[model samples]
Target chain A: MPHLDILKAAASSNQWMAIYPELLLGSLALVLLALEIILPKKQHAVIPSVAIIGQIGVLIWLAFNFHTVFLKPEHAYTFSGLLHHSEVGQFMRVFFLLASILVCVLGTIALAKQKMPRIEFFHIVLVVSAAMMLLAQSNNFILLFVALETVTVGFYILVSYFRTNPLSLEAGLKYLIMGALSSGLLLFGIVLLYGVAGNPTLPGSSANPMDFTALHTFLLANPNNFLASIGIVLVLSGVAFKIGAVPFQIWIPDVYQGAPTPVTAFLAVASKAAGFSLLLILTQNVFTPYEKLTTPVLAIMAAATILFGNLAALTQHNVKRLIGLSGVSHAGYLLIGVVAAGSQPLAIGAIYFYLFAYLLASFAVFGVMTHVAGGDDADQDLAHYSDLAKTHPFLGAVLAIGLGSLAGIPPLAGFMGKLLIFVAAFKAGLHVLLVVAIVGVVISIYYYFGWIKAAFFETWRAPLLEGETDLRPMCTPVGIMAGVALAMLALATVVLGCYQGAFGDWLLALKF
Target chain B: MADLIFYIFAAFTAGSALAVVLTKNTVAAALALLLCLVGVAGIFVLLDAFLLAALMVFVYAGAVVALFLFIVMLLDVQGGVRKPFKKATIVSSVFAFILLLLGLASFAHKGVQTTGDLGAAAPVGATLKSYGEQLFTTYLLPVQIVGFLLLIAMLGVIVLSKKFEGLEDIK
Candidate 1:
């Protein structure tokens, strides 16, 4: 009877409390829709400003009330989700919300500056951010499917926001087709899991729900269960496709190159961050019983993705495509933290911290790339960056900082992220992975600097750059984002390497 | 008597499912899928899930397939069938054969356990009352939230498909 009362109270309050993030974003989505409709076409800049402010408000709201409500044990924790919150959930939620807010700011100016339909772009982004918020909290496969598809539908539109651009349209179509296929695979996995655990007539335990906790217990009890193994494998495969895990990573570079630059940045950073966050939740919580297969599978995939992403990027001259591949390689390293799955405070903290680092570095790099090769950004080729140091020194320096950090050069956020991950991997006794990471970091140095060298070292016979080209400040948001990224990078270089103990412990204490 | 009813529906279910894959015209394939779904509903009835069986027929077969047909009409699927089966017939048959082998293996290994007594434990309506009670009490949050999300998804589809509130709230 008390359980009944507790359940009822939970159900009542969960409407406002458990799903606070989604509810907040839901309100934001509604406001955006209303504003998009009511606002005059010429004054569309107001729409993005409204959304940016609103999204930031949600982020602050999430941060301020973080551990008090969301971290509280009672109301927020309900349902059989693929993930639930601990300190890891809070960390991911805070960072993901922050990234999404940054993206909203970036998207506002980016689409407007490109002379695209600015209002609809903001609408889709807000709705998708809401879905992403739910995705980070999902502990059940059903919620996973629903949340992932919500985000995909938004991406399909956002990718083709430049409807007049054929490449954008093609990227949209490819994304839709391949995205639907991956969703199908994920659905199949969820349904098979349902088949395994949901049948009330399954004899021994008639208490099968899609709840992650019970499901984990059942799988652990029957560790050799073939059905459980198959379900977990398929789910992981679905997640791998989400994070651009190799063998399922074929669609990424095309999708990244073909979409609008801002959309690509979102896809590369926040979108991928959401994917990793979900992966952490699913593997660590739902499939904990089947860790044996999950670990080896992730290790093999991490190795393959890192190797393939790096190798493929070496040949790419297109700046966007190169960064796209770089995102894939970074996903591989994040998998090390995943493979090092234990109840360790430091390991999980490292993963979340690395995500924060990667997000800023990526945003800064791609933010600069919008004007990388041209003032008009005509060619977007590597050769265009030759003598960039002489022409657009600030842009070149910002790019170098972003790329250098990404390549894990010491004194940047990427290096700290990588170092933390390596330490975590070593602590987890992943000797081979630590070695591979070392070698991979070295390989990364060459490719990343190769671009840097072209930007600064090589001299071109071209005449003096035009004022419009050189003085645009890499478009409007580039300087601001560079500031954000550099500040973050500085933290990675100086603070994280030195003073991360308390912050890391606090991050580890987060509950989703 | 229930066993006979189950087997009859199961055969129809299997046959229609096969036809859905084998049919030539796209529309005909969709119709075959509808038939397959109906047969599945019949099997659900045999299992004594009165509400669920109704849902299988009304929601899945009626709504989902209808939506599929709506989309199929917009996209051309049957253009240039030119020698569709001649080259691939042998390969597809081999593939089908391998699938058959696997199907046989799965059923043989598992050895079907009769769910006959499961139905005897409770009648549909009586058990459903308890389920409803639990759903409203214990499983209430997921039920409500999924319902809300679905509402949002439906609203989204409407907003995208019917462009209202664009020009002074047009559409």
Candidate 2:
């Protein structure tokens, strides 16, 4: 009877205000659709600006009120324990919002070039980002799966938004299949964990086993349970697919190459960050008791992921594939941070810092790629950038800075990010992983510089046959909006690298 | 009698699942998947999870399999000729098979652990009213999120399939 009373009370007092940001985003998405229907054809161009400005408004509002609810010293359980809000969750909420704003900006630039229905793309992006915000804070399996699905399904559409290109459609199909398989694996793991945790005979068994705290208690009591270990591995495998670790990275190159540049960037940055966030929560909180098993598994995965990602990128001709593979190596480095977080509290901060650095650097590069890309978005190659610096010095500089940051060159945000992770790993005694990561970074530099070299220096080739003009698609001119966005990204990357400002200080001070 | 039914349904589900994978005809594979789902539903019924059984039949066996069949027939897929496995494919598949067998053997040997009898505990999803109450209360956020998921899925189908005309090259 008390349980019934509790349920009734929870139902009646579902505090909707705690998720005001998510609500605002979902409403903005709907408003875009409504505007698309009501407005005249010529006025539809204004809809994307509305979406972007509305998101910026939400971001500002969130920033102003960041400490209002869960910035307290402890975590707050809202939505009847479906959401666990903490400082990390708040940080990720802001991170996802910032990422989506950049995506919409890129979307506007990319969509303008293609003959596509533009409003739905922005709408889906808004909804997906909102879901990602929820996903970063989810405390229960049901909510986690639901929010993850929303993001994945939205990506399915965004990947194929450029449907005229066969490659885009192929990427969408591959993503759909791979996504479904990962979902199934994750669900299987969740079900197994639930069943085992709810067993009446088990010590510390929970009635509500899907709740992370309840499951954590059960896992704590049964540290060496066989079924729990299986579930843990399966869940990690599912997340591995999202972050593009070694064995699960087969779809990354193809999908990235085929997706429109903005969508590819979204996948490379936002989607991977979301995966790492989830992995961090699950490993550090729910399955922490099984570190005996998880540590070795993650260590092996990190080593292999770093090695494979670097080695594979060495031979790729396509720029998208190169970025995608390099993104895999980035995920590997973050995985090392996750492993280090088990012992070193600083690793969590390092992971967040790394993700932010990655976001700024990646958006800069992809922004440049978007302007440089022609009608056929999937056909960008290094050869197309033979004389990029000569033609567009502005874009070429942004590209260099972005690639430099990604390669962990000094005086860039990415270097500080990598240094933080390596320090965390060294403190945690993950010496072997640190060595592999350093080697990966060294290998990574060759390819990253190859891309830089492609832009800044022309490779000598046989003279073009008479009358065979260059067949490469003409690079689109950068708009004022895109130019400003790229400049902001490059500037932020440089600034964050040079100074551990208040933002960096706050991130480093965060605890799990 | 209940034990007999459980064994029968398990066999039926396993056999049909194998058929779904091995069958060459696309339509036959779809039908086999339906049977496999029905078998799962029957097993759920045996476990006193009537609500789950009903939902499985209604959702997966009823709607999803039907959609699969419709798409299969509408496309008039010849099921495509199967290509011979390459040397690498064969080697990798064999390796995977061995790994799978090892996993199954370990699971069979050590996966099951004894638990106290469950006769006293209330089954969470055994009835409709309680399930609805749970969905509206503690699980409300997930339900709303699922709403968005379905909405986007519907929008995805439309945006991906719809044809546009006289589109300008914006470049």
Candidate 3:
């Protein structure tokens, strides 16, 4: 060993200690995989619980101890600058772990719908969850892109989990083409950004932070540069594609319509939340100057996204398509926070709060969809939901709460999430955007209620003169999901509105 | 001087990529893409990262593209006969051309970092040694991860394609 290098090793115990959460989760993933194969098939279900425990423990560990890591952002010791060990990273790490557990339970419950195997599904969920966790907290662009791909490749498999279902295949194709396009755009933009960074006459501070802190400083130091602006747009486009934002959201409806209900819920909620987390970290760290320059572009996209999501949703009779469009509209709302960025912390905070609300609500709503329409997860028509409330009051009630929350109705968590976002937007001097956001919120109520009415008001009518069909049978497991839904809605009532600080701290601690 | 060479090779890569996309025949497209891959390698070489360029060719062209061609031929997805340019294609191509021009114009003004580290360019052996060291010391976990992924994929494919004793073969 070089004599001076020995001193470098002796100097950095804290650096090794910084990323203990990621290390623990990673080791736990391997242990879970091994345990899955070793454990008896009957009790293999316990594996996910074990994984969740490991994940939650990391969060608890971080919440108690990671503030010091956050304070010492410069103390990362990794493959050059590949992994950033920070409190913000530790915080976002929790999302990946928690979301994975949610997905595993939801997916395992949903597997009963199609009678698919659980072990592989659970294994893949954990793997995909690990990838999402890795991607969200990534500081380097190369690592970020790779992590996104890792999550998505697993997603492709999950989308097509129902092999015999033609609709599932269709959804898979749409996701693939659109995902590839977004990735191509992302790669091209990365190459260009590399070019811009390559030509510096002076050596950079701290060996190219490839992470957000360095990237943000670089972009901000030279504000007028078009490459930085264009790069930011390209990166945002990649994320928008993931979250199903407009212009990039053309693939969403088809995927939602075709995929298993649990998969759609996963896509719309947790996966989309991961995209929000990525955007949050990136905007906060990498494109701090993007506020001054790219505000107009974001404003236009946000306005269009809200308008398009609403107008398209109103015409859709398919419950899946409606929910899909609903997800897109919410993305438009989240973009308001993205637009506000570092200039308004509360706006970004609102985006994070809204993600939690949206995820829980979507899961509950899709849970009801799985319950009532026990077909091939393809029958998402309002007609399918016509007689739901009559037979299954609990499911209907859960559906109502989900739809109401999604529509931003007061006293529900979604409404509080939106109100906080509105306040944030106002702080950012986005009056026009705020008014449009409110209008978007109001218009959403009409569409969301339209479905609720169908769920609640199910009077039998004489068969249509032209054609007739039999409604599918509702399944028993779906009833179980409805129970999960009721629990989530009840939790949202007080958990989000009253104790806003609980989620607010978790979301805001995301800033690097 | 190196930048000029890099630009030349990069244009070659860009042109080759365009040719790959434009080709009507699948075989021709694959061939054009091969050229594009090689040109990208050359661009890497010109960037003073000779080892990376060599690795690009060795891994990308030698393994990935060869696998791609094999799968392309296996699938028999005909590129179909050439037709007159559709309005959408024209709009897309025009948009692409405009983007290219804008990119070039902006790139000319950008500050690029160039290194005069030509002598440091390692051969296949030395390059392998360094790459191995880097992967092991720095990216050991991610590297190990890629290996596990390969193992899983192999097991999955075996499961998918293998036959059973009692089940009637569908084919």
Candidate 4:
């Protein structure tokens, strides 16, 4: 009866408030699309500004609504349980908003150096960001599938934004094929789960099986169902692909290297964040009953992902490919947090903290890379970065600190993040995984420092031609904005590393 | 009579699906896919899901097939070349056969009940109306989200396919 009333009430316009952020962002995307059509080409520069401002406005709106949503976690289900409002969802929304703003800024800087359809880029990114936010809040399979596809479709274009680059086009095609395949797998999994859950006889029945709570109940009731196990495993594999885990890690390096640097940064941070959020939701809510079946599979994937990602990265000469491979390892570490969920009560918080730290450090490094590459793919070779410290000391320092943090140097955010993950793994009695993670970290330092060495100590190798000057980094406003973004991220990395307690306490307060 | 119609549609669906895979020319394959979609739509009609049947025809057979043909023509890829099957093809066929067997086995050994409550059985007209009502009410969020997904896809197409000044130079 209570659920029926919720369904009835959800049909009213009042339910609109539950999804105001998505609505606002969607409208903003449409508005940008209209502007793109109406505005003269010369005024295309204004589109990114509009996207950034609109995102900030949504962030402010989310902040104002946060307390109201946070206070009544019990009443968080809205749109008849399509969306869930929780502290974690709120945190993810903020994370996605901040990431979107940074991406928009980064994309603007990158677009300044290359001529393409700039307005559409901002709109598509905004749409994808909005979709990701919805994904974090999704409480049902239908929303999950749609949101995931929205993000994937948007990324297919963003990755190949530079169609002129054969590499970019190839990456886009590879991503499209793989992404479509994963989507098929995910849908098939959902169908299998749906069939097992049985079709709902009554509208909005507590037995409406796609609903998370209902699905949880069904799974608990029928834990030993073979079809359910297959369904869950299929779903997990699809998500693992999205997160760029091993065996599914084939596309990461190529896509990351081939995409425009800013888009690469977006994929690295926001796209991965969305995938991890969905994984968090699935593992925490849906698959909790089947932990025994899933845990071992996840552990093996984690170990393989860490080993392969780190070992392969050691030989990569392209900066984007290196970061992409290392990103796979980070996914492995994050999987550790996921595996520890049942055993460690604070594991979710640890995952959040780790993602937060990773976001800052990775974004800082990507921002510097975007600045140095200046929208050109040819400049991405590691050798091109040699002796950067001699000419651009500040840029060199940023790269050094960013890579150092990624390598888990002490007194940086990444170290604290790794420490939190390791502690959680230990508390969960995952000694083997903890050891493998440590080994992965040690292996990672070699290549991370290789980039650092190139940036700092290595002398410029190619002899200078007569009167040929090195290509000076662009000093445009977009370039300055990228620098500022990197500096702020670097500062946040250092501050978070130093004062871990504050963030830790805040995250711990977030009820899963 | 209904059983006869179901068998006919099923046969056509299977045949067209195989043709879709076996056809060497892209355009012919697309046409085979269209027939397969129509056959599936006919099967939906037999299942009493008239709305779904109609959508299968309109969306998949009509819109999607047309789009595929458009792309095939636009790319001008008219059976340019065909390569002989290689060792990789044999390996892939073996894997595909294994997967097909596994799927068949899983479906055959259904210990758990596959068909659950599918709502009160009603007349086809009422069922279609109720389906529309539920779509507009119960599943409104997903509908809106799908709308956004389509919009994003449209934007992606424009950005990737549209030729602009200086694009050729970069290529």
Candidate 5:
């Protein structure tokens, strides 16, 4: 029968080996759950270590096998065209793994203080990381939606893991509502595009329009199609919510302040990176025909995001909220790189470098926040950080370096990251956005410096009454694992800054 | 006949959807939502998407609405007094309203350009067999990934709700 033959052919193309990392991660997640059930209570502490080490193993294996299919002249369509694997996809897989390992490291410290289920947090992180890997390489919209939903649903539970905290619960509820709304918008856009592109009368329309290449061909044939343009804009808007761009950034501060610190870092770094990688793929490849519509929308959002993020971060005493808003500004800067990627190839590498810089600096800063945070996870404040350097020099130094890099200070990785993007933006003749980004960088320095000053230099305050006790949460002493992670992050930040080396060249030289 | 049925179901869905939003009583609103889903299923049937229509009715109208009713009844949630809109809310809503108008106007003007003859090629999700075959074959990866999604979601529910009898040990 033709049908049986067709099924056999399609089934034969399901290459499970191409996604070994994701498969290994999913298996590891299940193993963690099984171990939790089997191991006695005292031995449960080893579970987080397993998650971290297993992820590192995956990362090592990935690195060793990097050139197995790296920079192939053509993209590899695996799993029957559901995934389009390229060198960029490989890079993102590595990025997500690194981010997950750090989050797990921070999760141990953060979870130690909380009276919550610890094993589940690690399980969710692994599954979410695996999902993000698939999301980055999704060739079909079905896989994209499925992978994205897995990540988002994992976050909903992870966000509210500390259910004892009312703030955490509130953040979870807000995220659920807002996330559902964004997904609705994205689904509407996808349905619209799918409907429009499958119309047989349309030039270059495809039988399978959900595939990115198929949709790209349809879009190329109908560059000015109205429904297609609307769909593109709506999809971009949904992604904007994930990256915390202006107008879609209302949920950031509350969610950040209320979420446990490590999860906040995950949202700030990994989730944002996932969105940008998908955005890069979408705009650079699938949506290229709609550049006329996308470029202006992105440019405007970038400008607004930069101004809003910096301005809002000012006047925030809550350190988590402050970092969260600053992250918004970083998203703005990345948006500039994304817009410029249309005209400048260097912008792609610049964007990835910036994300790597962000991952390192953000995890460094958040690792410190995890140590500084006390029992009430939601109430971390800038005042609590006063005299931090005098008390704990290591954390204070890490904080200063992280913040300085974030502020684009020279000889720091963030400085190099920002410089590369600015150069690309200049080459793209986005002079207006370039100016907006500069002003944003200057404004961001003020708040970042404010944080640094709070840590390093003590400001005068009224003496406490005899009955009043100090409310500041005492900084937790660094553990061996956390210390190593933070030190590695800080060193990487400094080293990558001084020398981009062959790594930078490889990233710049990547095909889309 | 099909066009008439499509219009009727479409109207029914839209009207009940509006009721679901506007109604003050929680149970009444939920019932309206059920009607909305049924109407959507009806429209799906008119469009020759029998499997989707049945699944919509079965999964959403059957299971989900029942779950909603159980929760609503168990909580006995009263419709509290509505707060007045804040300045930001009002301003943003107004801006959103204008944008919606512009979007609707543009869609009305230009969305109808695609007047394609419906092709003989069968739609992917039109039947249970084809859907199952596709799910187990070409779309196997997504299906497996979705399994993980549900697994985590289940774990999340337990993590979020399970009472900690051994809190000390957990810590």
Candidate 6:
């Protein structure tokens, strides 16, 4: 009777504020859509500006209300446990907003160069960013599935935004098929888990079992249930597909190579962040009871992903494809955080820190790619980057720092992130994974440095065009804006690496 | 009598679903899909989910099947020709078989059940009302988010299909 009463009370209570950030972004998307219809095509530049402004506004709102989420424990479960408002969710919301702002800037630069519909591109980015924010707060299977699908479907359009490019279309088709298949697998897994949790024969089972806490209780009660194990593996496989882990990462290189550079950047950072957040949530909350069953699977996948991603990137000639392969290896490193999650308190913190560091470095590199490869898909070849320093010293420096961060070089955020992850794994006694990760890092340095060396040491040999005098002006307003964004990100990377102690402590203090 | 009706609908469902894949003519395949949807609706009625049955017939059979027919007719694809089966067919069939086995193994136990206490004893009318209540109250956020999803899809279709001013020369 008391349980029923509590359920009724929770259901009736209005906690709309828990979803305020999502609501703001969703409304902004609609507003942008309306403006797109009403405004003249000549005035389309305002759309990206408006999108960027809205994203910044959301970040400020998040900052103002951050304490409500972090300090108050009673506001955690809103919409009857559908959304969990916690410090981790708050942090991720800010992280996604930051990423969206950078992407909006990159998208604007890309849009100005290409002759595409500006409204749809910007508005869809807003919608997808909102979905990712909601994704970080989803505490139930229904919300998780819906939010994940929203992000995936939005990315499908963004990936193939260049409708005229056959390569982009091909990448879109591949992504759609694989995405649909993974969604089916994820849904099937949720159904199986729900069945086991809601089984009346099981003692202390709930009538409504999609909630994570309820599922956690059921899992703990029946830790060795055959059906649950299958469900866990299936769900993990779907997650692996999202994060571009080994076995399910076949689509990464093609999609990254074909997608618009800004979209590729979004996928590399924000989409991966969403996947890692969900994986962390699942491991810490629902799969803890079955840790004995799940950790080894994750460890093996992590090692294999690191090996495959790095080894394959050794031969890739395309810059985007190299980054794509390297992204797969980063997923492997993130998976180490997932494997050590059960035993190490700082594991999730390490994952988030690595993601933040990855975001800055990734966007900086992708931003340069966006400007450098303007209006030409053929310009992404690595050979084109020869003597970039001689032609564009500023961008050359940005690319070097970005690549260095990705390679986990010292005095950069990437190195600090990797150090935290390695320390966590070593503490958890994941010796084999730690060794494999170190080797993966070593292999990664070879390819990263290749790009750096090309930019710095190789000679520029391409003939100048009729109108181009000094390899084109790199000081236009758009160029200046992009340069400022990259410079800020590079500065943040160095600052975060130096201040890792304080940042990591703050992240680790948050309870899931 | 109910059992007899269930068997009839189930057989129709299986047969038409198979026909949907086996038949080469696109229009005929669309018609077969329509029949399969109707058969599934009939089965839903047998399970006493009257609301779901109506939705199945109206949405899937009426709207989606109509859309499929329109697309098939518009494309004017030449069909009824047997094409050589490729390696993809073999790979897909193997995966399909493995999925079938996994599904069967997961649901084979007598103790396995899909419905909980709330679904066990409800009459059709009461269940429908409660479903509405749940949808409006507990599931409101997902419902609204789905609205945004549809909006994004609409914008995507327009963006992909429309011919902008300067894009025609780029290809």
Question: Where does the lowest 10-residue lDDT sum fall in candidate 4 chain A?
Answer: A198-207
What is candidate 3's lDDT per residue for A1-512, written digit by digit as tens?
67446445433432444456655655776687688578765676577567656666766776677566445645653545566655545555665665665666566556665545444555556666666766665777767776677677767767777766888878887887888899988877776566565434423422343555566666666676666667778888888899888788899889988877777877888788888888777767677666775677767888888888988898898888888988898989988888876577667667777877776677667767766656467776787777678777777777887887788887778888888788888888999988888888878888899898887885576776666666446545444533654566556654675676655776754555
Name model 1 segments beyond 4 Å from true: A1-10, A13-15, A74-83, A113-115, A199-208, A343-345, A371-379, A459-501, A508-512, B1-24, B67-78, B82-116, B120-171
> What lDDT is reached at residue A125 by model 4?
87
The estimated TM-scores of all candidates read: 0.84, 0.97, 0.86, 0.92, 0.98, 0.92
For residue B98, model 5's alpha carbon misses the true position, in angstroms, by 4.1
**Candidate 4 CAPRI category:** acceptable
Error of model 3, residue A193, in angstroms: 2.5
The ten-residue window of minimal lDDT in model 5 chain B covers B113-122
TM-score of chain B of 4: 0.77
Which candidate gets the maximum DockQ versus the true structure? 5
How do the residues A189-231 of candidate 5 rate in per-residue lDDT, one tens digit apiece?
A: 9998998998888899998999999999999999989899989
lDDT at A399 for candidate 6? 89
Candidate 2, residues A394-488, lDDT tens digits: the string is 99999999999999999999999999999999999999999999999999999999999999997886688999887877777888878888999
* TM-score for the A-chain in each candidate structure: 0.89, 0.97, 0.87, 0.94, 0.98, 0.94
Alpha carbon lDDT at A490, candidate 3? 51
User: Model 1 chain A — which ten-residue stretch has the worst lDDT?
Assistant: A371-380
Instruction: Give the range where candidate 2 chain A is weakest over 10 consecutive residues by summed lDDT.
Output: A68-77
Model 6 is docked with a DockQ of 0.38
Candidate with more favorable, higher DockQ: 1 or 4: 4
Query: Judged by DockQ cut-offs, is candidate 2 incorrect, acceptable, medium or high?
Result: medium
lDDT of 5 by residue, B106-171 (tens): 889888865555747667768999889888898999989989999999999999999978979666
RMSD of 5: 1.5
Could you give the TM-score of chain B for each candidate, in order?
A: 0.68, 0.92, 0.68, 0.77, 0.92, 0.77
The interface root mean square deviation of candidate 1 comes to: 5.6
lDDT digits (tens) for residues A1-512 of candidate 6 = 87576457656654777778878988898889888679866675677788888888889988888878523777678887888877888899999989888988988887766677777788898899999998998889999999999999999999999877787888888899999999998988898888788777776577678899899989988877878888898998898899999899999999988888889999999999999999989988888999988898999999999999999999998899999999999999999988987899888788888999999999988877776774565248776677678878888888888999999999899998999889989999999999999999999999999999887896656788788675432322436667789999988888887776776789866557
DockQ class, candidate 6:
acceptable
